[model samples]
Target: MFSAPQHAVAVACLTSVIAVAPVPMRSAFAQSQFTDVSSNWAQPFIDTLAQKNIISGFPDGSFRPDQPVTRAQFAAIVRQAFKSPATRLSRPFKDVSYAYWASPAIDYAYTTGFLSGYTNGSFQPDQEIPKVQALVAIASGLKIQPVGSVDSTLLRFYDAAQIPNYAKPGVAAATQRNIPVNYPNAATLNPNQQATRADIAAYIYQALVSQGRLAPIGSNFPASQYIVQGGSLPATPSEAGTGTLAVGTELPVQLEGAEPGANLVMTVGENVETTFVVAEDVVNTRQQVVIPEGSKIVGRFQPFEVNKTLGTQFTASKLMIGNTPYTVNASSVPIAARKKSSLSIADLTGSITTLAASAALDSAISGNVRFGSLVPGIIQTGQTIGKQVIGKSDTSDEVILVEPDLMGLKLNADFEFLPGSTTAFVDPNSANLYQVDSGTKVDLAAQTDNARYVMVPGETVPVELKTGRSIYNRQNEVLVPEGSLIRGQIVPMTVNGKEGAQFVANEIVIGTQTYPITAASAGISPSSLQSLSPADFQGNVIASPEASQSLRGVSSTGEQQSGGLLGLGSLIGGSGSGKKVILFNPTSVQMEFRAPLSLNNFNN
Candidate 1:
């Protein structure tokens, strides 16, 4: 697989690409616990490489990332890092012998088009490898050819004159391939500088990225600003280094339909699927939303154990960020719930939990036992219980429902954004020229023509839009245009111990197109309900006791009206009659979306 002609050119290049000073890397291997990386700028890069065994710390437990690396050690590193087959004939060198520690690696590197021996037939393995030589080795081994003129590509770095004549093409190819990582300032290539351990690690990582062996690093990485894209600097400052969605980014996620610090009940060992929406926007340095609110984190809420005590935790498997779906490694804190013997169905939070727990405690429970006792999770029924309890008549604290709180989850693995994911959102000249930021609410006048529809919990009513409106940004760009109807549900809730309903818009329809929407209204109740006279509600809210029952069990599609009932809808409260029922239309209702909306052919 060796190329004879290219091998001749490579031998000429490596001999001239040399520097004076050299450092020895001879040491025993140890996992990374570098003594001096606490404040190093390249700590993130070094840590990752060390963890993967691409590089290692010295025997004394010091990485000394800034120290220079010699040619022989670099050869060993190349062997450890890459696995390509030899494509060029290997020639015997006078300086390296079969007994040499790096002799095999030297042979592999030369045969793979990575390194070359001197014209005198001697390979100076102890010479410090220069940055240009290291970069050329990676580019050549990977067969990275410059897209355009090599001279123009090299000009991005201020010290273009410092690059040697023969190595220019390979160095330019490496820059084009994003293998050159200039620290402090990307404009200076520092071609003749000695290659440090940190420098080699970063170069190899970027090479892996170019080969698609690793995910693209975040644009905001310091070294990435120097990466020449298509042979030039990024067109815009934002493109130079966008926001970093780093590993361990704590995403503040809100459980759908659940309040903060709210208690969620589940059984131990019981697995259930649930979704949580992002509570806020994860913005970049440019204030553009990366992961907007309402992005769903769907996962399994299953059993966990901590300190030998049973608990529950959420292990996320799928992350739905806008239109993109990603498999993720993330989870929430485990919560240990109170153990119990039995539980009532009505006391549960989700629908999956229905069976009684610890059925052996039936004798301890009287017929039609009250909810004084509660238990969490799926409890195997028909099992015997042997509890050493001191004579206590009241079982209120024994068998009862347990509530676990789900605040937010954390990313367990590093996540990188793919290129062009946000390019359209930031490009003004692009087809998608407008963006409606998160928390952007629109005041939509009801489109009712003197007819009202009554809606209750568990039912969705189609609220017609009037003339509607055209939403605009501060720059006077129209984001969303008029002509849309809101299909919403009257979500039942308890506000300050009083029954109320919140209008949650689930979808919006414009002409024949339907788009999913997350919008809501300030809940309305008898105590806080605002009354709009028949004339006041031009054609807003429509209500009927009969239609409310018909709309039950239906979500997006169904008739909003069973017959003509042109008036305001009544909010029925309390079961089997009691307090009072009132007819009202909630004022200050807004159709603001809970997530980011891009007008460029917006989809889910």
Candidate 2:
């Protein structure tokens, strides 16, 4: 195994702080110092500001680092150091009682749009600050913006997704601005974990430096030659685009069709309902027979119950997917309510595919929540049972169901060209499910070109593109076919007096090839760029990503009885011995359907 290098030593040897301007150092005087403000970690912060008289020890000669800092105390310190020029306060939160100690600071932070309150109006002032919350506050105190979309993909820590919602945006913003020096990976925000005094000092100091209020610390590293001056950085050529591919989403089409050596390959459609199981019991009034073997088990519900005791198994149950055979295992529950019960179709658990096929049978026999209203006709005393109505009822009891609908189409076009051929053209209107409407072509440039064009439309040749951003690429160069899965922020651009919306591509997968563009490229505010580090790369080498299940739709109806039959008279009478030959009567079963819908595709 490769040994890991020490981070502290690596930072010390490889990186050095840089500054835009030289800052003069100053020291605090006797009267300006606090006598009691003392803490192991607070000293570094106090010492750094002591020269400028920004902070001092308290009269008690103690900093009380472990003690939680009240909102009022923090506000006072912030006001004293970075006084806002705002003339009035905006009381945004309902719970910041006027008597609260940090009322002024809270009010100031609100008016400056640096802080917001929760749904319930209360700012528990004494609560210890969380790592992410503190980072946000520090970044807000000193403005910061990240240079590019910061991907937290590499963050391998467990519970990475546990970052609270309230602090995610702020934490991301701070990370982008590089105000928090502790972040070793993009995925691990470690928000809501307690903050230490030493950590607080480091955060504040880094925030100050990022805001252009402080000078570079000691130590010097060679200036990077790759640094580019102001204005948009010159684009570097990348062979392939980078981005995420969402499930049920369509992406860009590569000039080369998907093949064995293709750059990308699709694993399988997921989140699709593939498995299902029939619910058990409910056969008799008091003690009912449980059927051990149930109807068609589905793959979708496979995760529900593995080899555990399924309480009362079903019998004579069949698992089917269209015409394919489905494998199902059965077990019994020791409950003695119904001495010996037989399992029914409803007792089986299975995949969505199997459930769709057996929907009619299930609805007729199994009283599902969706089909409970249509009770089966009962066989009362020796004659006719429930009357069959002919005319339609006054109320709209007749329900109509629409089956799962899908739209898919492909297009092939041929254009004569040579090996260095570069071209840019709008997609022609076609009959395919995905089509493009009219839009501005101003900032729209070429995404892929002659760099790796080894084949023409109809000719076969090997092709390879370098991976990175390209010079010809624009913020609007990306194109998404209508009905394709798309997400991220929409950047507004005005071209020729017409305001148009530009969707920065976040995740795109055309056919089998996948590409994940940064949210920033999708036009989302850099401040909103959530952790998306390369370490977060979740897709296999064959595809962009993978999901656990899939969805399907089917229709069904079934019948049930309360159990009360008395037709013994007509049985011994004429040649018709109606001694209940068919113990279980059949009922009209109507099938229903359902489908899995993804939010990525706007048209779908």
Candidate 3:
């Protein structure tokens, strides 16, 4: 492990040849100078040392550039250069063969704490010096400590993982100190294998110069121009440091904010950057995200909540069915709340691109659905009861569903908001309006409180209203037509008076169309209905004709009252539908109201 640095020390000892050779043969010295070395790629330190005759090639005339250095040889060279007193030898290892030439060198290195033998007592002097181990020894020998923290986060070398674990800490210390040129490609740091003679020479020479004991090594060299002045490792690399993947890749908006995810940002160039989220990890290799070099990408997400225990439901207050509008009132309309159900995202917005709703919701909800009710509305059956009353009832006073304010559901998605897609509703929370097909309707009856109302761009709550009264069946029993009851989120309501009283749901929000609940066929359970007086049913339970027959067995005298069901058609008046009405009121009207008027007067 320590032989490579010892070889460097040996090369340093060879420095004596520089002074003696120049005097003996100027021709030989010039021939051996830095310019004479044909390895044009050699760094400045190697060039300087070659000129000094401190390191040389074999008689075969080929400098085995990849060969490993040995301990005894290195020890001899270091002794020559430093001229330090030798320490007393102690036979620490059992395997030191009687004729082993490195015994003395190994003894010196061990005594000085520059190297240590294996625990088994063998000094494998012939072993190649691993890159990391070599770096540690060099730092130890030179007593160098680079500035800044040893941030593995800054390393982007291709061979980062190849660095031996034992040498990492020392190498990191050396890197910060700027003593060793550990990486040549900026992309690779081959920690193990062999330490070439040229590499060893370069390291030793630089250490000498950094210590102010030797002159600067590479002064007048062509390659010197490419050296980044005052170059330092980055605090955060543009890519994922060390690993195979080139990081800082961006993804599309597959989910809304209510998702669980992480965003990673890296610096590509000075101020040039990109971002990615952990959500992209699922399809990373195949689905590579490509973005412009300088553009910033964001991860949009949508997440879902899964309950391991039991299923649940929630009721949302505001619901949009296509273009129609609907409201969930505790007094009038009721909604189902669900606990756990698979979620699929049909759309997404406000991100770099688009992502799948399932992907988004996975992390968006994760372990906690406390905030899940923000986007979906679902409720349990038999959860609400509609009260039956007689006279016109006021629904103004009642507390409906209670929910927490959620920021948004987060997902692993790529989504970008189209310009002007966000709009504000009566509630100040701005909602992202979705242009979906009008015919589609989704039944979300198994979501939790966190999913009741979704916090879209403009919508603040997690629970959004669904079309019609959200009916919930607790025992798996089908409540045919009349049996399908509408229970208010707050007070219970039922049909009253001769003809069943007209019940209007707060909203009928389908996929993209939203209409008011006005059809006479729509009825509420006397217990589930809100605001209606019990007497309003007049013995007639509002139900489909088929349901009426099935209820004959359970019919009460109140529901069988005959004449009590007449003249009830006018209760809701004519076409109690969703009417868009605009009014202009003036204290004084000087002219009659006219349609399609063309004003001829010009502005004064």
Candidate 4:
């Protein structure tokens, strides 16, 4: 059996080694002087081990706490802390040579049953050990055993999915022995992350403490709570009672009335009826079911004010839980529907002229406050007129009618109530319970390329989801599924006299229902660089066509035209007339979710 050196002798040997070792080989300070470990979670452990001379900082006076520990370094430390009787019949690893600096330590570690070579008979001493491997090695050396089911004990960790099958037993034993010290959130056991120097120090110190070789420190570090003698196993909340579901529990419901190709108009006070179903189950901290899956939610659209300067707002009102009609003070959060107008050179010049002329007329008409304010109103009216004449033809009038399917969308619960409870207190902060955040990319394909079809603002265009994706939280639970329907609208805008299309995602449709979502991405195909020719800007406009077929639109007059809006004129120069041009080529679209969505609102 491996044995640690007696405390007094170990301290003496460490002191003597420090005295005899060259200055460059010793730590810059006699105590904890590691610059890098000062604020580290494992600083205490590192300091204790450093003072004992079992571990040392770098020559630069810095302890790289997060740096991965190599097998050789670990072996050296193990040899310093522990000692075992050598067996006469012991054999050295084929790869470990006598001349190697770590040869002695490796031999000692192997003979002490603390380490072993690979099946191929090579020690690979320089290899960086994984956290799991390090823990397993320490557990095996100390002969620790699990007190309960290994799998059950591991489930206590938030990142249990990262634990490897082979390391389960060793990890369970380590946890039971209270030898594993996790930093930051003790609930998160990052088993797959590389074992760092700080991690090793903590593991070793805990191991020594468990073996009655060292006294425990009284630090409130998160890892301290897991020490066996210091504390008992963490208490898990009982799963017996029914937990309360917070009042602002959001149900991801799909819209049943809104369908593709439905003619819709933007008008204040418009009422659109929609039916929805809960997407996921709502469970509280006690793991008790609160809102069961498949609960139906009914809602209707209310007045949405459209402000030319600020943006448009859509609100849902009269929300009710199906037949049961649970009291809910739920209202659809006002979604920002901003419109971008495509401005051509003529439109910009005209608007400027109208405003200038209106200002001059207003100045001549009156110089007082009442008339002064009238100048702005007149300018605004002129600008509106200018847009009516110049912006209409240049920009598409298409708009996407939003009818969200919330069948599979995920939402967080904020109110507290029992399962099957009829009344739920609504929280005002829950207004944004269903907003799918930005940076979420969903694969979308437009029915027709901008080259073949003109998408006007406010016009609904058909888009098919091409790929499926899942959204997860830090706990790795699937909150949203792949291939869910996404609703988007073409936002037209002019930049530097150039017209462009910006697609803004509005909602996600799942299982015949819709939920409000906000996502955006550059409309370029993800694989466009690899699949298209560098010289051809419109290669991704259509399906793979022959080179000759793509070139058919290029005329001898250098006028290259596609079925879309601006064609090649925008690329090379708009017919040399100095007029702004727009390109209407169909482009690939991807959406990425921006917020952390809770899966408890949806059912599996």
Q: Which one wins on lDDT? A: 1
The digit string of per-residue lDDT tens for model 4 on 218-251 reads 5454346644331223222222112334322455
Query: lDDT per residue, candidate 3, 174-216, as tens digits?
Result: 5543444443553455667566655566556544543333544
Ranking by TM-score: 1, 4, 3, 2
Give Cα-based local distance difference scores for all models.
0.54, 0.28, 0.31, 0.46
Looking at model 1, residue 523 earns an lDDT score of: 43
Alpha-carbon runs more than 4 Å astray in model 1? 1-70, 77-97, 104-128, 136-156, 159-186, 192-250, 257-263, 280-294, 306-309, 339-408, 416-604
Candidate 4: list runs displaced more than 4 Å.
1-31, 84-89, 221-604
As for lDDT, the candidate ahead, 1 or 3, is 1
All-Cα superposition RMSD per candidate? 26.3, 31.2, 34.5, 26.4
TM-score for each candidate, following the candidate numbering: 0.36, 0.29, 0.31, 0.34
Q: Give the RMSD in angstroms, all C-alphas superposed, for model 3.
A: 34.5
What would the C-alpha RMSD of candidate 2 be, to one decimal place? 31.2
Give the per-residue lDDT digits (tens) of candidate 1, residues 1-604.
0111111111211111111111122122223368876456566557665554556776566778788888887887776667666888988899888877677879989999889888999999889999999998987886666645789988888899999998898988777656777776778878899988878878887776554345545544444565545344233423322223543357777555555333344345444556767777655322335466677776655444533554555656556766666544455655555544344443332322212333223334443444344354323332211221121223333332334333346654334443443222222235854556545677655554433334443232334342256677786755566645665544443333455555556455655554444454544553312232224324444543433343232222332332423312442221222322223353345654533444444432
lDDT, model 4, position 530: 24
